[model samples]
Target chain A: MKNWSEKTLKRIWKGILVAVLLLIVFTFSPWVLVKGKIDPILFSMPYHLWVSILSTILLVVFTGIGGMVFYHLKLKTDPNANL
Target chain B: MTQYLLLIGVLYVGVLFFLSLRSRKEIKTSSDFMLGGAKIGLILGFMTFAATLFSTFTLMGMPDFSRNNGVGAWIFLAFSDAVMVFFILWFGFYLRKRVGSESFGGMSRLLQNCYQNKGVGYLYFIAVFLFLVPYVAIQIRGVAIFLIEAFPDFIPVWAWSVFIVVVMLLYSELGGLKAIIYADFMQGTLLLIVVWLVAMNCLDNVGGWSALFEQTANTQPDLLSPPGPKGLLSPQFLIASCIAIAMIPVTQPQLSTRLVIMKDYAALRRMAVAVGFFAILIIIPTVIIGLYGALQYADASTSSFLGSVLLREQHPAIAAVTIIGLFAAAMSTSDSQLFAMGNEFRGLIGSKGENNLTPIRIAIFVFAAAALLFSLVSSNELVLLARLSFSGTGIMGPMIILGILAKKPQGSFMIGLSAVALVIFIVSQLGWIPQQIFNMRLDLLLMILLSLGALINYYVKK
Candidate 1:
């Protein structure tokens, strides 16, 4: 049971790591590759709107990373950490 | 005006009622209600933090400051967030590790453990309650005014106040922290969208950043500079801003709760970065909007048609969006304040065990009523109220820092800081003290002396 829980936790952490990296890429990438002028429906909105959307997305991603890190830290600290 | 406000009031009351019903099953104990069973994940936590931080003051007042004072106000406000984030990163982990209590009030308990003095615990608890209740009342008043101003057809200010109070009480009583946080998450997202749209619309109306800057420089160059016409950005203002920044984190009940809800040090660290970034995004636009308003209506007073028309005369499509944003900002903070005050009141009445939350419900009503009464009687502007709250918290700021540093902060030191802070607050409020003293602002001077006194006591004991 302990081994299985450890494996599951590890997998969750790995998934979170990939998500964080993807979020970082999405957040930093400013270039939108389109064959023509930016489509209003697809890419155009107010600048502040775009910033809010990006900031909210980043906030969620970072919070996920924080949760995963917390779980791992708990696992290390407790004698019977996993339920 | 009253008829429209009534509709808004009814809508808010209905929402509160629904939330209350949904949350009824969740409130099994004080911990469940107060800390959400300490099981809140990152999403809810982030939202709750965001909601509490952005109040009606931020929604309405930030723009107002920018309009009157310029980008300097924005910078000063942004500096508070940066300073708070830095402190969170530097000290949050340590505080969380050392004192695993669930509330800022719990920090007082920790101090008692260190000093073996219940009086110290009582002092901390009293200070938090006295200041936080008034701070919460300020938020309630801000929301009432915003509602009255925004939806004159559907929500009368008094009815709106009653509606908000009822809604907050229901959700808070029923859902506890869980309901509050979930509501906060939704409200925070809505507020972010609403403010962003307002900023965009304002920019578009003003013919973009360059035009806005040029207009300000050409028409009202003095307003573009620090210490605008009122000298708000002078060294005295800057010093006061810095002191406020430091003191804000220590006393803000919403931010202090972040420590309790966090899962661990890593979560706290991530929260710091996320919250810091959000603060930047949220504040800058509001400030710009204020400047936008100023540029558009250089001679218009806030009470003038220009001020009202700029915000309210949006396109039909965006009108609902603007109202929602304003509502979200007001409701977010109002709900959190209700929850915090409820908990504090429970503690004050000496309630414990499962019955602790009973007084909280009553306390919420009392607080809401007090705020409503104050709103009716007082015409103190939002910025002035905000500054007063910040300065009020400055009294407890040194003691919070000292409690963290000292294994045993002497009872005398805590009492002394409290007394001195009280005197300064009273003197400033009474207008006996000059607004600027010794080329330093009163708040800055008080904070310096408080810190120095605490440090001296620490060394003397050592």
Candidate 2:
């Protein structure tokens, strides 16, 4: 049971990693930064800025989730892993 | 305003003095002084890490950068920082596991142990010194330039620089790493509050968020989009910036040392998340202030824009806090880097330098003196100079990552390759060579070459 759970968690962790990378790539893509697009503003911010802001906030959330998962794996592997 | 500045300044200094003396009482060994006994808690850990990372550049330089460059500055700094925090979650783990707190003297010593070559350690030290001194100098210079503007008749720029260095040296020498961490906690809090207060002030004056952007659109429509009005934030530039910033924890000794000193992986994990949140919260206000500068002081100089928005427009009490906050921001980062360099030097000298703190103390002083001299001559382009520092130190990322991850790194050839790359990058910065190779930035090209070299070295050994 422990082995199965660990394996499942590892897959979730890898998925999150890929998601974070994709978010970063999307943020810098041409669609978000089209030369002079200021329409479709949210919270009164321009297209590129608002989109990048959402990307940043999402990245932070993903980081928090990823940290918890990695910490769980470490604890399961080594109960005395203080260092 | 002057009176508020004096009162707040005195109180801030008093707190720094008390913290230093309190920390001094706890220091029993050199390790206790240099590494805070390698057991920092999550809150203090996050605060110090955030404080050291943000600094004068985030406070002064980013607003100026955004004002000139446009909203793409958000992608340039905040987005890059978000990526960096996630990077810490991954890199911090392997690094801690490999160094293992007990054997972790500094990156220089750790690389020496990994590669089994003294020259590797020496080269790492040289790269950090070359890049970091200018970085420290700029922080000091940033605040000094602001101070001379705020109080034109009060003191000269060089005098303000001297005063900042002296105060930084005093507290850091008195209490060492622990004292510096306490100072970082205070500075981080002050910086957050001051930045938000100033941002709100700017927002209110502009009639709110809608009007601010609307006005900015009416005036500088290009700022609201990417590649900016100046065409500075191209995709290539942003990608290169992301890579440099992501490598910060892996390469910068001060931040890397913070990763090792956390009490456990769990604290480091929590701290990473908190720092990510902190990065977002702090940078949003900088974007707001930059847009404010765009609408009101569009053609103003960097110093004039900062002086007007951060001081001339705010309430007197808030303006006072801004000055002290800027001072705290400068010292928090400068002291950390100067002290870390001292620890790096101690790591190089081996057992003979252990137990006695005198030589490390002197090294810290010498490093501060060198930074002081550099500040006197350095330019006012804080953000770009900071990027140069980041990319310069980042040239060593491949070597350091290999050192930490490999079981037995026989990549001594990497030492020479890194040195040649470092020299070429420096020469390019000096305009001795073109900054671009076939339309790609020289820094970007060199980073790619070094990573490829490290990969080949790793596979051959495998």
State the lDDT at B331 in candidate 2.
90
Name the best candidate (by DockQ). Answer: 2
lDDT values for all models: 0.62, 0.90
Q: What TM-score does the A-chain of candidate 2 achieve?
A: 0.84
- Per residue, candidate 2 scores C-alpha lDDT tens digits across B317-359 of 9999999999999999999998889889889988855799989
Q: Tens-digit lDDT track for model 2 on A1-83?
A: 23547777788789999999899879988888689998898988899988998999999899888988887777676564543
Q: Compute the DockQ of candidate 1.
A: 0.04
What are the chain A TM-scores of the candidates, in order?
0.49, 0.84
Model 1, position B86, has a per-residue lDDT of 51
Which regions in candidate 1 have their CA more than 4 angstroms from the true location? A1-83, B1-20, B101-115, B151-156, B303-311, B348-354
